[model samples]
Target: MVSLREREAELANETQTLQTAADLFDASVSEAANLGQSSASVLVALQGRVDAAPLATAEASRLNLLQVAAAAQPVSIPTYQRASIDEKDLVDVGKAIDGVRLARESLPPLVTDVRDARSTVTAALTSFRGELSNLGSAIESEAAKAVTINDSASQSFRAAVTDAAARVKAAQQAGGDGLAEMPVYAASLDALRTENARILALEQAERDAAPTTPRNPGSGSNTGGGTNSGGGSNTGGGNQGGSPDTGTNPDPAPSQPAPDPDPEPVPDPTESEEPPIIIDPEPAPSGTVPGATS
Candidate 1:
């Protein structure tokens, strides 16, 4: 039997041999970054060879480069079998030999795959660029259409406004009832006035809702100039300003209270059957006047 040290040595050699085979296989399968670049460069150079080459010729050149890349094969890497110095190391040697042989056999097909993949990537990139260019053109066309539509709409709005203004002017010059002269224009004017009133009310509401601080806290209360002036004139001159009751109710005739109704007439006592007789509680005292009471 082989010594343990010898067996270990054989194992180490076997491992190294296998690792070399794996490295070769990896290199064969993986294409370098520059593999397709060389072919693309050749195609680009050919474009400059002729002054403005035909489109067909340029496309053909590119296709030919791609085909050449697809057809190219990778060179096989040389591999070595681990030498078996004795029968004890034969198993490791056999395994190493098998691994190296497989790596060598797989290289050509792997290289072919790498070349085809590179060519496919290049073709895809070219097609993508073309599609992007078309998309850009379509976007520009749509943008121009939108601009045209906007201009047409603007012109139509301006024309409508001018026509309405002319009709309103003609109706005013007619000097009859505005509605009689132009019903449609009058209705539109009424609608506009109503809208303006609504907008005014909304604006007032918004102003009321907004928070405010007095600018001059020291100043006394100040009513709005127009509102106070108009209100004072309508309330029977400013002399009546002191009476809170009279200011709101300008009609004094209705403000006076109605008089009370007369009481019901007493019944006529003389008309009754009874005659009047003066009452005497007792006889007058001796030597007293007849009418005197004691």
Candidate 2:
């Protein structure tokens, strides 16, 4: 039979454990929800990319057409006079020359239209590139966030599992007739264990369900190597900002000059000098011959 004090202490410990487990579980749930939101955002961003793909293709076609037209050389004609015997012949010849002149005049507008189309396509291409870059960055950022959430959840779940296991072992050690004597304590412990198990399962599932890291489309490598002639170096550096070797001091910055050492303390000349002693003349007050040998 457990004493009241022992039972109370046990209940207190169990309650504390339950509280800890509840906190961990709540954190895990919050993290999971955040990850879900991030994933949804990524999906929406990707969908936008998909929708823009066709526009990019169409723009590319228009650009190519305009480029071909822009490269075309203009044709020139030499003026020629036709012999006319009557009014009918002159009118026919004039009509034919007018038709040729109209066609020649229309060519310039065609060229202008082609140039404008090319410019429009080029702008569209620039926009598409920006969209793709933004989408890629967003996806990578979301993936990193998801990874962080999962890692934190994993740690929390492991800690909860360890705590619950310890409590269950302590309970068994207390010898309480198979957990029936302390119903509330037993129930709390069981609840903690069950929650911990659920957390572990969720962690595993998340791990398994995680998407593979995306690679650059142009690069054949799975490690996201971009297509730069300067090897696999990231053109814009790492994710955060700055270069990859930001902290590494292989070469110190040239702007910062080396610090000078403290100057040696100069010995004070006055420290070595002796203090002058003042000779007080003997009090001539009472006296009469002050200039005497006193």
Candidate 3:
């Protein structure tokens, strides 16, 4: 018959093994962080352009993306910094191997803690990688989000352009009342032009990403990618493992129990990490609310 002491020994081993595995998990995360950083760089650049754009454009979808990005803060992924033995709550069954009653009562619980920690680490990696992928895809294809000026929209688009041009003209030939509305009207026209130019730029970028690929001999799409400012989330679990160590045993468990001779008792894990705060690229500073339909 397997002695309770031996079984408890097995549980202790499991705990240490899992803690070691958790330490290595960060290596896997570093690669994901690198990929996310690439996408983040591009996203930031586009955000800057949007910020400088005139508020008259009133692009709500873009603004919403901005808000989301702000909410999904902490885009930077960190590598493993922990080096010390992370067996804080991990029960050292070896210490209690001689205590049959204690081992029976405590060993199983230690295994539970070990398994949970590893699961937490695994889950965090999955979520972190997934978020990066989503954010990248959103940005690389974001140019598609602009309002399309197709046949249905052409009338409104032309009207806006005409109105803006007329306003600029009136402003230039300012008289009494005209002078009062001169600056306002002229500023509005400039905003309209900026919006128009943005539309054109997006179209150009789209064409660049996947240029018309001929079906015959040499084929190429020459595609261009884009970004949505709603920054990617790291709503994943926090980095697992303890502080850095020099291959030494971790400190004894802090919690008291007549169980482990050395290792400490683990408490129920409070798993979730902080939800990141996304940096939003706000609209232009001209205090212009979006009212025009461009």
What is the TM-score of each predicted model, taking all chains together?
0.22, 0.24, 0.25
For every candidate in turn, the CA RMSD to the true structure comes to 29.8, 44.1, 56.1
Question: Mind giving the per-residue lDDT tens digits that candidate 3 earns over 1-294?
Answer: 454446556655644554454444434344334433443433333343222232212233233333333333222121222223333333443333345444345545544554454454445444443433333333223222222322223345545444543443444344211223223333433454466777778878888897443343112221113222234422332112323323233343366767758868775578546667889876754756656443
Candidate 3 local lDDT, residue 218: 17
Model 1 worst lDDT run, 10 consecutive residues: 176-185
Best by lDDT: 1
Model 3 scores worst on lDDT over the 10 consecutive residues at 73-82
Candidate 2 lDDT over 60-147, as tens digits, reads: 4334433433443332222233334353565665665554444445445544444454444444434433443443333334333333
Q: In candidate 2, what residue range of length 10 has the lowest lDDT sum?
A: 176-185
Q: After superposition, how far is residue 78 of candidate 2 from its true place, in Å?
A: 23
> Model 1, stretches more than 4 Å misplaced?
1-95, 154-294
TM-score (C-alpha, index-matched) for candidate 3: 0.25
